[model samples]
Target: MKHLADLLLLGDPRLYQSCEPVLESELPLVPDWVADLHNVMEEIRAMYQFGRGIAAPQLGIMKRLIYLNVDRPQVIINPELTAVSDEQDELWDDCMSFPNLLVRVRRHRSLTLRFRDELWRPQTWDVTDWGLSELIQHEYDHLNGVLCTMRAVDAQSFRWRPTPTH
Candidate 1:
């Protein structure tokens, strides 16, 4: 399979459309796609020096899959936010799809997520760190066809800034 090159940019219809769940029949492809996503994310990070997580929709795959390079790299399949803490924080958010812009948005400070690992075994992750919570929430929004731009606090909160390329 060809490695994904162009991530779905902002205003792309695919980025705003809900992705379909990966069926059992498609499980075999998950590993390869996850690897592809990993490669693309690493390439993005190398060039732009940013990007911690990526969802399948950003790659134009329209599947409920996300790869996160937090403490340890992991692939999340069919992820669902089981719960969120009452605390919320507003932070600048960026995405691979629109690397030139940053939007300030509010996100839960803590959240509970349930997802299947690369092996298809169910797993639960309880996130309390504000940064990780925001990262996961951002990917979760992608799975639901919501972008940081959509969640922007206000027009004045959106700003265009070039990604850091060091």
Candidate 2:
């Protein structure tokens, strides 16, 4: 039952540390972790109106786990990216960790994700859509201690998120 407050914010040292893989013996712990990730991500979506996925490190879990709920809920554990396309797309990327900032970064247009599920079953997803590709890559980077800010296109690739006027 984690909340938005439990999310690790930008500048937190733990957020920059590479995560460890979830062990088979730790499968029992994944449900609770996924719940926390889901709760926090939902809160981010409600407050900021944007969030497709989140990684375990974002909550200080220090594991290679990702919870994504676009059209449905998906649990990705120990994910590895493969078959990444050379084609790239540049976009303004936002993160729950730094809700008030955006980074312009280039990402591969497509990639294949291979990971284990909550039940420890191996799974693979071929992501080709630009939006989904970007989202997956963003979350994947979190597991490797890479942030969008670290991938910025240039010195001028950073900007404050525009506040909404009600």
Candidate 3:
């Protein structure tokens, strides 16, 4: 589709520079933008086809936006982690930013997030377990211009193991 082709992929020269945070209250949450996000979510979901979360930056949107399908379609702006999980873990997460590339990233096993709801209401929720917590962390990283790959502590920490042959 011509529309899909317009969305630049990683390393594409036209991918716009990300903008600074647009305060939570400033987001266009009406059905137009929100509904469009649903379409974007579908494309992003299908784009990865086998991944967890995808951020707006990965989709070439400069806004501080995130869309995930774990519990609900969590749309967050200016998201910040108020509290990290009591437990911590090193997780191997793959990103659509780099297809088929996986890297270990440290994340709180749980979190209490201070973010706006879909309606732009300031709310707090305790994200338990990996699904919601990991989703939140992944999206939050994008807002901060940090991708999953950069989380790897060092070059040695990431290894691409090809198929073993006899």
lDDT of 3 by residue, 90-128 (tens): 767766555556787787789987766667788787888
Check candidate 2 and list the clashing pairs: none
- 1 or 3, which is superior by lDDT? 1
Q: In terms of lDDT, which candidate is strongest?
A: 2
Model 3 lDDT, full chain set:
0.63
Report how far off residue 49 is in candidate 3 (Å).
2.8
lDDT by candidate, in order shown: 0.88, 0.94, 0.63
lDDT of 1 by residue, 100-129 (tens): 788999999999999988788999999999
How many pairs of residues in model 3 come into backbone collision? 0
Question: What's the C-alpha lDDT at position 101 in model 3?
Answer: 66
Every model's TM-score: 0.94, 0.97, 0.74
Query: lDDT by residue for model 2 over 1-166, one digit each (tens)?
Result: 9999999999999989999999999999999999999999989888888899999999999999999999999999999997899999999999999998999999999999999998899999999999999999999999999999999999999999888554
Q: Given candidate 2, what's the lDDT at residue 145?
A: 94
